[model samples]
Target: MNTYHIDAYKDDIYTCVRSRCGFCFHACPVFLSKGFETYTSRGKCMIMKAFLEGKLPASQGLADRFALCTTCGYCTSVCDVDRPEIFNAFREDLRDAGYTIHRHDEIKETVEKQHSPYGSPDESLASRFAWKIDHGSPLLYYAGCTARYRERAIAEAMMMVLPSFDFLEEAMCCGSVLYRTGYRDDAMRQARALVSRIERYSTVVTTCAGCYKTLTRDYPVMGLQIRPEVLHSTQYLVREYKEGRLALSPVGKGTKVTYHDPCHLGRGTGEYDAPRILLEAMGYEVIEMEHAREMALCCGAGGGLKSINDTMATRIGSMRMDEAKRTGASLLVTACPFCVRNLRDAGGSELDVVDITELIAQSARHEK
Candidate 1:
């Protein structure tokens, strides 16, 4: 067995180290916040190269540097190298070498015990939304950890807009943070457990970009084939609107709002238009930020960075918030609940931050 995950990507690591194109530098959220080439994808590739060449040993300091990444994949957007995959593999190698970050280790433990990194939810979903659930419905609404625990309103909004759907009685973690933080084995175990519970559903919809990406992309890559079709809430809602099965009541009434594409949903899954379409349908004039869609900046909360180094994460999020403000929009809307939480933390009272589903719930007239 290959003890080091990076061994599978030796050639790719060498390619990044040799190219040294710096295409991934200025746009890297960690690099932008830390002002260090070591935080850039190429710079990290150089570190991996050094490790492979036996020049650098795995150490606590090295692990901390690797943990700073948001895994946003912006580097891969500009270049041929799959930087996020390589970086994640390198993190696994570091973890196996006993250089794991403390917070990440705690999270792994929490997820193993509680099925969540955010701890037990303050309230039970079954108690809160039991009346709205249809247990026999083919469609299931999966409220991911952050939505169920931290941003309850996003889940509530999704329930208000969705018609005839069943919900998981309790929110599950989905192992996104574990997978991103170098606990792939633990993540796989969690994935298998969650997969067994939801495979009966024909479709699983969620308001979290992180959970959508994990279930649709990462789970399969980890060799756990999910049976249900996974759709981000934006994708599901837009389809209903386009098919004339859903109605919107012009809640925005021409108010200008800018959309921020979540990294996992946009760069990870190639979903760029659904959220914007839904926003426009609800009567909001959409403004394009300087960095929107493919080139959009990360909200700085993904890949366990928020738990590891919150100050740096908030600084990077504040930068994205500034970009939204420059567009002169009154509200900043996004599809993912995680994006809303981090951007809100960074922006504070400066501008309103909302999930697309939240805005949709306000405008929905439930034509069906």
Candidate 2:
């Protein structure tokens, strides 16, 4: 019998262990922030190999080391292996062994009970924006947990920019958090429940990057496909703008703003241009960060790292903030609310961070 869940990744892990290229170390958010090899993709592969070889025992220390990753896929960008997949699987193995992170457990429990990791029933956030929900509309807006509870502006901006769209009466966790944190079974349950709730709509749009990826990509991977078409708010906005259906007033007279790609949106789903196109449409000058598009740095809150190790998450976020500041841009914008929250926390008073939806909403010309 396989000793650990990561046994499935043995070939890939062995390849990394033998290669020792260390290419993934270049910009791995956790490795960069923690300044340790154990946090990098190659390093994690080594740990997996040790476990498979029966040289390392499953323990909280080992679990903590694996939990440090942001699951950003930067390593996969440069290397051939799917590091995030391997890391997430390893986390599952650790979880099976009862070596899970405390905070992650709490998040999983809260999500299972409240249907949201934010520790409240879905009704709480939906009621705050009850005026936005319209069952008659075909287009439904899914403001993922972070946007609904943490970054209200993104959801509000999405509704403000869209002339008419339906909002789900209750907030639902997309299960992206649970999936990334090694609760695959629970994540699948949430996915099925959420798909059932929103499958009635003809079209579904979401303002959160994580939610967009989960709805469009991850769900299908789990063999549960969404019935309606799912579009990220940026994708929908850009398409509308292109068709002349949406009018955007110039928000900046060429004011420079840097864009940060949420890992899930950019690499996870290969959505790189929609958000930038929307930014340019709003008349804002787009400044490219050194690590933009496919190679963009993670905001540090992904893969449940923020909940598990906030200090390290913030440190990694600060590194991205520093990169944004170097461009001398006046503002920093990203599609993911989780990115906005973490970047804003790290960038406070140093650089301005806003969701792209907020800027687009500001530039939208609503019919009076």
Candidate 3:
């Protein structure tokens, strides 16, 4: 039993560190991958205690383990107290150690080189679909680096159904890559620049849960009060439908689907309803995994894990997708591009993983 972490975790970050925050065990894909007692939240707390007490110095493997965490906030959500800010505090620890992965390094390098995360976002990418940067609207549609690169279809879905908002697709990083990898200064610098660019917008929308949380919660702490608004597609869509802005018909008339909450969207930002609502509204028979909503498992691609631990990350994703499969659903719907990409790679057609927007678009009769 280790105790004493650091000044950042000096307080009872958890209401009761003694109790196992089994949320991770219940919903975390990483624990499923390792299955070691040490991989669970109890293990994480012990490890942090060792660091605080100087019993364990942060070694390379230890650092790797730390980096492996998806920072999904599942542990914190289940904790009665402290609520898991330790993960955020760990970013400072990584910065001190000067440890980073290629994903973070590549994106930060690109951001420093290019104005945005994507070094060379061709107009063709956006033009390939109907979505445009400026559609005479107040919202800024951030496609994020992942969607801009591989998951281009998700962007196309955004163009078709949610066409009413203004769009700003960045080939640039969201400072999330840097933030998660322990480059706080670089992350803040990028966040400031982004805040400057989008300050005038009435709202900011994103397809990436990572980007959504980064802009909504982290940026504000850095004095980037992004006033317009930050919303994931699911949330915005639900709002739109309620406001009469979106007319969601029963698109998934007969499809059976299950939803996997992105770590950032579900736990980071406390969003769990809009997506389920969207599925239910669309006539898709939505199924629930044992670990649903805040207790949702991570796809293991987050916290730069996909960058540093590809094999393990894929394994973790497979574990989660396996759970979706158990629900007996035809499709597994996720709101984050990272989750969608990783889950697809792991599933390899064993299951169908789709972005919420694309799922809707497939069955949707566009209003416009």
Candidate 4:
């Protein structure tokens, strides 16, 4: 059945192993945090090579090492070779070999039962969409799990800025968590369900970067396709502002703001300009952090790492927050709900972290 999709990357994996290039070393969040070669992309590739060559057997220890990665695709952005695809395939192989993390399993089970990875009490899909408004516009807002559950403020902000859009009352987990955690079958199942629900819309707008990337990038990779055009809220807002459909009251001059590029939005989907464009349009002085855009540091909540190793995830997020603090910006803004949650959790009261939509909504209220 060619389950792992590893055969196609066999040659590339060999080339990477032979080159022994360290280009992706500093790019990995886990490796940068732990200072271990085994946590880097190159290190993960080496382990996969050994497994493919039958030099090592699958073990819990090996699985644990693989689980450390956030899979933020920073290495893929920098690597001369395609490392993300190979790494994803390696994860599939690990799962197929019956090696899976317990937290990931629990998440998958929760998703299967409750249509959410949060493992919260069962709630009707309608309850999640209680805030939904059907403006009868072709655009539909798919507020992914984190935004709908953990961070309702992001969704509320989106509702404030968007003129008229339908909410995906049938929306479930976008399976981003499952896909990154190596539950391919479960992820595909969720993807199929989401695709079916969104087929009626002409365009799908996502407030969550993970949902945006999953719908636009990961679903197609899994051979599941949605007919509607998908846009991140920032992308949609930028387009609206550019087209003169959306207006924003300018922030006070010299209001310094810095942006964090969520890995899924930046490295995963090649969207580095939209959020910045929106911020600049709002008359805020946008400062660049040391790692912004393509080289942006992960917020450390991705790839089920937050679920598996929260302490490590928070440590990485705190480091990124430190970088933001160094920018001397009064506010840190990002496009992803997951990034907002993780960065806020790590930054605490030291830094103000907000989603772009929240800022936009605030600007709109100021115009009143």
Candidate 5:
């Protein structure tokens, strides 16, 4: 029996455990999938409480249970009082206990040697948009780890859209993988190096929602200030709209698409509008999955989960694919390459998953 008590780190989450049980369970994908108290937000909260109070034995099971948590914070969104950052703290608790999974080790190895989780940043450094670079260009494009290896089409699409961006001369490692896993020292060190390389740029744009969020939102803590007018691709698309530069044809009668909200891009950073707006501009008759926007479900591959616990990430991603399939969409579109890759991996047997960039670039026109 897992005896549950409140831990000091979990104290931030204490307010949501109300006895009235008002939490809307049907809204949570994790709860729907697991159908248990231990996996539900309330259930996990109770478990953390018991562990903190010394009511439950700290064991291997504890690691699995905590690892099962997606840290999505849907529960906190519904709570009368919110403590959305608790899962991060709880993850730290697990790590402090020497309970990290194997991917953590692999990622650390990549960061230590290659400065990226993908293990190679060289081939990925090439940009189709390099021709746009001029002396003292104000814009730098940041291609995240997955984009460097698996999703070049997205970068290619943005290159087609934004004409004045420069790729980083230095590999462009943002160190988000370190920050998420509580490797504060490495994250800071790696982040400083990235910041120093970009000191010349007045703005930076990224195709990766994770890199955009981490650089713009978290890098300031180290006094590196990754805050150079950062724009996620969609935000740049909306800017294109304002500039009257992006052109689109209608959905052409048969094409239907749905959007998958990347957690960091949507809920974490409040960026649901730009991606959807871009899709709308492209004339996609956008249908939505059950969860969308700030309340949207994660595609289940962010926060280094795909590296650490791939089976769980795949399972969750498969479930997300099923939800997208439910919409009868001909194609599923997303912004994050990680989300695109994970969801495509999920639906490769049965559905089509692609980056919004790839979908758009297929028909995007170049100025004559």
Candidate 6:
């Protein structure tokens, strides 16, 4: 029987076990919601130590505890020591011990069979690029699964905002869903496939935070070499605006708008300024949420948590919406399609949630 082991993470496990600092306690959304130490990073590390030392056996309950995390990287952002690595290692250990989440398994099967985690047979390689443009540029706009299927408006808005990029006709899953759900080998395979598809492009632009992070950060970490430079659409827009490639129409003065930093975009990649800069340039009053930038709260759609327990995900997203409400902004804008989807679902009638690209496209000034 395969058993949980921490040999690779011995140093991090020891540090977390010995310190018990609780620095990462409040940073974990799961811990805050569950009100249990077990849901916190430090607590999870302790559980890993126990399993490694043979004091505890790998069980479904333990697996569930690890799954509670959204893996937003907030704990690691605030921790003096590396917390994300230890948490991820524990997840891998859980999978190795014959424990895995059913939803994650389903996602893996879907991605393997359909090239999408959504399990929709309608979404094929051909359908992904049905809106392709032959701009004759070496730039490829990779509308990831979320943007392509779930948040079609974001993809359409991206095309409107920049009508000169080629869409990848053969883009597959970015494997972020697989990696975050502890299917490392499957994620690696997806990464290899994705790299081969876009390596010829000079730049790969993505509208999904998960895809941006996966291509720019996770792929290299997994030893997959993607030759093209990766840029988030927000980042690319900022450059376009700076280089006079794109023009924006200013909104009415005092038009209040707030920005929600998507986990993978803000904390995961430290890109909190470009979107705000664009908003400010568009003449909207960019109000900062109480938990803005590095400390921004997640929209609860990440790390496959939405698939596992949608009720919990909705609750978390509602909490974020409440914060956005506190800002007194008429609109809540985010750079990620996933964030827009969850925030819109949770915001309901109370708030209006929109992707930055949508806002930009609507306000774009087309020069005749």
Put the candidates in TM-score order, highest first.
Answer: 1, 2, 6, 4, 3, 5
lDDT of 2 by residue, 1-368 (tens): 66666777788999888989998988899889878898889888888888888899889999888888888899998886778878888899999988999899999999999888998644565565567667788899888888887788787788777777787666579999999888889999999999899878998999888888888877887899889999998998888888878888888767999999999899988999999888887788999999999889999989888887789889999999999999999999899999998998887579999999988878887534
Q: Give the Å error, residue 86, model 4.
A: 2.5
Find the 10 residues in a row with the least total lDDT in model 2: 120-129
Candidate 1 per-residue lDDT over residues 1-368, each given as its tens digit:
33568878888888877777888986799999989899998889899889888889889888889989999999989886668878888888888888998988998998998888887657665576777889999999998989888899998989888877898776577999988988888988888889999989999999999999999988878888988889999999888888888998899886999999999999999999999888888889999999988899999998889987789889999999999999999999998888898999998589999998888888887674
lDDT of 3 by residue, 1-368 (tens): 43222465655533335655455466555677777766666676777766777787766566666666777777667664333346545545644666545466786787788755556766566555543446667877777878766688887777777665565544557788777666678888888777777778888778888899999887876567877877887887888777766776777888899999898898888888888888998898988987788777788888778876789888888888888999999999999888998999889499989899897776554444
Q: Residues 1-368, candidate 4, lDDT per residue (tens digit)?
A: 23345777878778878988888887588987899898888888788788777788878888788888888998888875556656666777777788878888888899998888876733353354455566576888887898877888898888777666787554388888888877788899988988887888998999899899888988888998789999999998888887778887896357999999999999889999999988988899999999989999999989889888888888999999999999999999999988998898887589999998898987753222
- Candidates sorted by lDDT, best first: 1, 2, 4, 6, 3, 5
Candidate 1 stretches with Cα past 4 Å from truth are: 1-3
Tally clashes: model 6.
0
lDDT of each: 0.88, 0.86, 0.74, 0.83, 0.70, 0.82
What lDDT does candidate 6 reach at residue 176? 92
**By summed lDDT, which 10 consecutive residues of candidate 6 come out lowest?**
121-130
Per-residue C-alpha lDDT of model 5 across residues 1-368, encoded as one tens digit per residue: 32222254454445445462747465555566667766766776676676676687566677666656555556656663333345545656666677765666678778878877877665633544457755467887777777866777787777666656677654556888777665656788888888777778887788898888778766765467653688887787677665767665554246788888887787667788887777777777789888888677777776666776677778788888888899999888889988888888777568788887776665555443
State the displacement of the C-alpha of residue 312, model 1, in Å, after optimal TM-score superposition. 0.6
How well is each residue in 1-368 modelled by candidate 6, as lDDT tens digits?
A: 44444577777877877888887876577776678898888888788888877898889998887888888888878775546656666777888878999888988998998788877634453354455576467998898998887888888888777666788664389999888888888888888888897878999999999899888878877888789889999999899888877788886357899999999998888899999989988989988999889888888877788888888777889989999999999999999888888787787579989888988887776543
Give the backbone clash total of model 1.
0
Model 4: lowest-lDDT 10 consecutive positions: 121-130
How big is the positional error of residue 87 in model 4, measured in Å on the Cα after superposition? 2.5
Per-residue lDDT of 28 in model 1? 92
